[model samples]
Target: MKRIFTFGVLAVALASTVVLLAGCGGGGEEETAAIGAVKVPFWHAMGGPLGDALDELVLEFNATHPEIEVESISMGRYQALSQKIMAAVAAGEPPVLAQAYEAWTGELIENGSAEPLQGFFDGPDGLSEEDLADFVPGMLDNNTWDGVVYSFPFNKSVRALYLNKNLFEAEGLTRAPATWREYEDMARRLTKDTDGDGEIDQWGTAGQISAWMFENLLIQNGGQILTDDGKHAAFARSEGVEALEFMVRLLTKYGKVTSGYEYQNDFQAGKVGMIEGSTVSLSFMEGKYTFDMAVAPLPAGKQKGCFVAGTNVVIFAEAKQQEKEAAWKFIKWFTSPDVTARWAAKTGYVPVRMSAIESEAMAARLDEVEGLREVLAQLEFASYEPRSAAWYAGRKHLEEGAVEGALRQILTPKEALQGSAEAVEAEFLGVVPM
Candidate 1:
């Protein structure tokens, strides 16, 4: 991880070019009472409605707290934001707060780029017991490392099946499939060559195959990504093979899914029946689709499952005490039930705190949204992706192998997954289970 983050002089110079002064406050016990307003620069990857919602929150926070202001910076996408964060950290000028993926949290911690937030959690001005209890189970704990909390959940999301009800009705289906086999059967039935050209005009389902998707299927099939001890890769077992084979068979046998963004575009265009996608799609699909859309929990295999996504806010250790305090204030306010609920309602992200979901305001908002209830229900079965420094490297194997085995048919599912496991073992760890 350090090797990947070691920027050359040119990279450092480039990072310097991107630096901007964030805040106006100064710190010292003597000057504490007279401290000026602090401006916190927050780097985030969200765009569209999600970004708008974040900006709204920042505006509200700034209005209420005259002593602190938040400046939201858009970094395009998560990948671009992540790369910029690394470069910024290497340049010793990280934002006081930035959004981070779970795997990125591991990297940041390992590189000493992030500050452990346990002190804030346990401090006098920290979260109250009632506040602590408000968070959904595992949501807050997912950000903890070695018993220390290091991050706070921001725009979290889980997988949900987006169904076009008009298309389902055309197929004589009244509801979404409840099991894997049923889903596969429906996928085949819904696939169509409407123009008599023998070319598929409508697909039943489509989603990018990545480690997050693989992990969802693996867990749904009663398989784990790693052993209990977390020392070795364990997704090469029979259950894992079943998961891999099922996804590959969708393309090779049923020929339902299209490659790349075409599937999503098709779904938006009302040419696709259903899509396995994140709840965040709600924001993306708003006011644009031609069909009546509904969402349902993912189909079950050995068990119901899906992967949670979105990033968390992590403060930088390199920040001054005043800035850190100001950043913490923003983090706390952002995660508070009322504020978090407002954000979740405006965007499609899940509310981290249960109290937020149960709030009267949130209840009213959920009643207005078409598919949000189903998304919240999925939280019961969703799990966070693995947090590991090696995840960045190991993840590439699955992403590439998914294309090789599923779409291109260059290898069998087992061979592709096995090759991925072996590559992860050789490159990231020593010996994964075969």
Candidate 2:
């Protein structure tokens, strides 16, 4: 998956706020713990309900190993977490472990902050292979960099299509759009100016247009961000162009797509018939909507699908031997079947563990929401985006480039992706192979 694409390409490799990174630093009120133990501090970005889950997870782990006490701390969202990590590094008080995005790990690795888990992950009790044996193949790949694995999968997510079932019926659409072409057609049909005035009252779609979302569309159209080995920009080609172009068309051609937050507001108002969003967003929507709402697999593309996001658990190099061991143990328990199922059920973050997914409880959960089942089905065909240290910064370039193309309609897909690729390439300072 992502690791292969990155490793294959570069011989290399190579987050969000709380709640934004549901498995990140958001909670845990440590009333008190054992007096003498290998104390381990883990900083993450999970918050609210999800944070509660991670705190509970720590309590579960502590029940058995009293000697290894893990203190889970919430450090805020992606940007905030990034700042906290940097400040901690500066103060030389970095935590023992961190639940970070791939890019954050890259920055840590470059700064000599993250410890390479090569030996441990590859060793006899390596969680990479043993603990994750039940996890998705892609999660294992995503954890790898060049050849070294620096982290393990925690909770993960993807861009999913949420359809207001009532709207679907109102439009006489038999099924959700199978692809963006269908997506486009349905969007226009679903859009209406409910009032007599000539302004759009209902929109067919709306969603954040970050590089992650663009990756979804680009890969779907058969384009890749970089050469498999991470050698060059692959987006200047057809798939990338095709994907972004579709968005531009959605905005300018269809007038149905608008970039907005409060996706629920629009959808609940019956102003948005179809919307694209994260799988984790389902928990909030599940109980609120009166109209039937459904979660659909990210629409298919020529190349297939890629999960939009997920965070990783990376232990810092600064950790003492005991703390590192303790951190690894927490990672193992987190991905374990019973643990993974409970987290996924409560938070809606997909379980990376295969065993957890196969459990009877999970089967029953799937039966409850056939829509989410579609998201799970993608697991067989799912691939992670090319995981690279550069991807963190690279995504920003892709974001700006896509927004420019879509909103301003300034560049064709080719020009837009080429510009983005070039921007990414420029960051690497070295001679290029002829």
lDDT of each: 0.79, 0.74
lDDT of 2 by residue, 67-181 (tens): 7778887876777887898899878889998888877777777778888877775666565446656667677777777777788778788777888888789879878788777
Model 1, 1-434: lDDT tens digits are 56556656668877666663212222111222224778677899978788777877787787777787677888989889999999999999999999998778878888887899889878876998888888877888899988889999988988778899999999999988899898899889888888999798877777654566667788999998766766566888889888988877764455444566566777889877888877777778788887888888888999987778888999999988878888999999989888888888778788998878888768987776656676687787677766775655677777786535655678877787788788766655553321
CA lDDT, candidate 2, residue 41: 87
| Least accurate 10 contiguous residues by lDDT in model 2 | 11-20
Clashes of 1: 0
| For every candidate, C-alpha RMSD to the true structure in Å | 7.9, 11.9
User: What is the alpha-carbon lDDT for the whole of candidate 2?
Assistant: 0.74
Best candidate (score: TM-score): 1
Residue 430 of model 2 has an lDDT of: 62
